[model samples]
Target: MTCLPKCAVLELTYQCNHKCKFCSCPWYAPNSSYSIGQELNLNQWKQVILKLYDLGIQAFSISGGECLLKDCLPDILRFINEEGQTRGLRKEIVVISNGLLMNDDYLQLFKQNHVHLSMSLPGIETFAQHTGVDNANGVLHWFQEAKRIGLNTTVNITVTKKNYYELFRTISLGLINGASSVLLNRFLPGGRGLIYQDELALNKAQLNCMLDTAEEVLILSNRYGFVGTEIPLCAIDSPEKHKHLRYGTKCAAAKDFFVIDPAGQIRTCNHSPKVVGNIFHQEIIEDKEYWNIFANSNYHPTICQSCKLLNMCDCGCREVANILHHSPSAVDDSTELYVARPAKP
Candidate 1:
């Protein structure tokens, strides 16, 4: 049986604490302005979640400019947990945050609900450079606290040109700080990321170097897991992982992982502009054709159709192609252009 995505990402809020240069928020810009429009209330978000549950999605991830900022967050988590339990669905909840606002009370809620936690780590000294926050180390402490409380923690490092050189170090520090796994994400041009795309984007060579290090980290951190999302599969150190990566590492959009923005808009994923429907509209939710649009759209490029590695990489990321060519369906192998850099021990 083919493994399909069974997750949904809910952008709880567009408001954030850090002014990361590479942030992918649609309305965010460096310090000039933030959170442009009204966001869906807690009730509205619940409706979205309920619809997703009906769709047979078992995994839900809550994110935001900083998801922890919402005062109703604990209630939100509890509601989802309770609803999933009542329905007898084995739901997996994930919370993504910068970790600065995390505390004992929130940790308790997460622990009680069995939520997996992931914190953003920009890099060592480059945290300030990437996040535009001085107290970067403070954010790192949240992961430790999460681990202390027995919550499964994963460290997310958004790989950009500014922090590409420090990728390995960031992964090491994350593991040392008690993170159970590390997810290295390729930087995409969106939100504030578009502001400095040229400067922040990683070249193919640099990404390959990062992947090489990813393989080494997997070997070194035997107990910990490593995944480089949105990176080319050809760049991976092990051909052995390619088959599994084909299904596991593909864009969630290509599968069925839906996204609900703070505004209640349903998208295939954050990177794609195509809005399948709005959760606030019951008619839209009930209409199968609206969702079929997302399911029908083929993200794979024609260039990718003939390759044996087709499933492994899927021609990089569609959202990236959307940004580079102004068409989500266009083909772009930007990863192939970068000159490979040497991997560090």
Candidate 2:
């Protein structure tokens, strides 16, 4: 088996200070046992990270309703750095946070551990509304602090109908704040997001418009030496540019990444409910079924099979296909749901 550079996303805790309108947790489900307050202890986290390293995983991003809420995240980073050194694993650890709980001490901790920090900044004013916060100035302040302290910083903007128009402005702000990169994510229609689907999700045309704007921003970033990181899965226009963006890496979730929930259930992606194995007790790479599912699942939309850009656009998100199409099939030429029509020969 080929050893790939795997990126693991550890959801430290589901509990978040901000209750956004597009929250994706099944918080209100009557039978749902998941809690925002749940978290893995420091020891358990160490074990999981070590196991993943043994399996050829090289990078990891710690996320949550807000990772800073764990209180022990600083210690976790220190442990990871120590363990990673002993194993010869040059792991790139990233902490995905809401930028609310960060302080100068935490920034120094991140610097000491060589940790990259990614902040969620949906938008300026509209994002504040979604998070129920009056202003986004505090988040921006932290971004500046992280940059000043020499921490690699990135901004994640989850685009929705409410703040779609602010896409260009958000990108500009990210650059001004010294963010190394910016990621624009589309709102997934699940959890609290499902309730605001009509208000939060954009139709095909609107999505195209957003992409158009993104292209211009990318050019601007290039001119100013800013690295723009747009989510390819949600990009609806500029298929060629999407292809260029992928370069050599495949979907991060295609067996290249893993998500371990608070209860220790392992999944290939955050959106997947299926548990591949348990980091608490089992080796996921040893499970034949786990590999089979990942190998068999195709993310390419049906139209992509025939499109020249098949390799570039990995057919979108696998979770989308599983949830929307009700199957784990590789979106070959037969699947029409999200497939873009190929140009007539």
lDDT of each: 0.70, 0.66
Pairs of residues at least 3 apart in sequence or in different chains that clash in candidate 2: 15-36, 300-315, 301-315, 302-332
Candidate 2 Cα misplacement greater than 4 A, ranges? 1-5, 26-38, 223-237, 240-250, 283-291, 299-309, 330-339, 343-345
lDDT of 1 by residue, 1-345 (tens): 112258878888878888888787766634533334478777876777787677677878899869998877887888889989989976669899988787888888899987999888988889888887776577667778878878888888888778878877888888888888777777777667778888887776776666666666666766445454565454555546432112134655736676777787766676655555666665554434434433655666665566576655555666667656866556654445322222332
TM-scores of the models, in the given order?
0.85, 0.83
In terms of lDDT, the poorest run of 10 residues in model 2 is 223-232
Residue-level lDDT of model 2, residues 1-345, one tens digit each, is 434337777878767888777766554323444444346788888887777778777788888667888877888889888888888876668888888877899989988998988888888869777787654777778888888988888787777888879888887787687787766666665456656767887666666666666667767777222222223332345546532122221455645566777656666677654556666664444454644656554445555567655555555455545554655444422112244654333
Candidate 1, which segments miss by more than 4 Å at Cα? 1-5, 29-37, 234-249, 285-294, 333-345
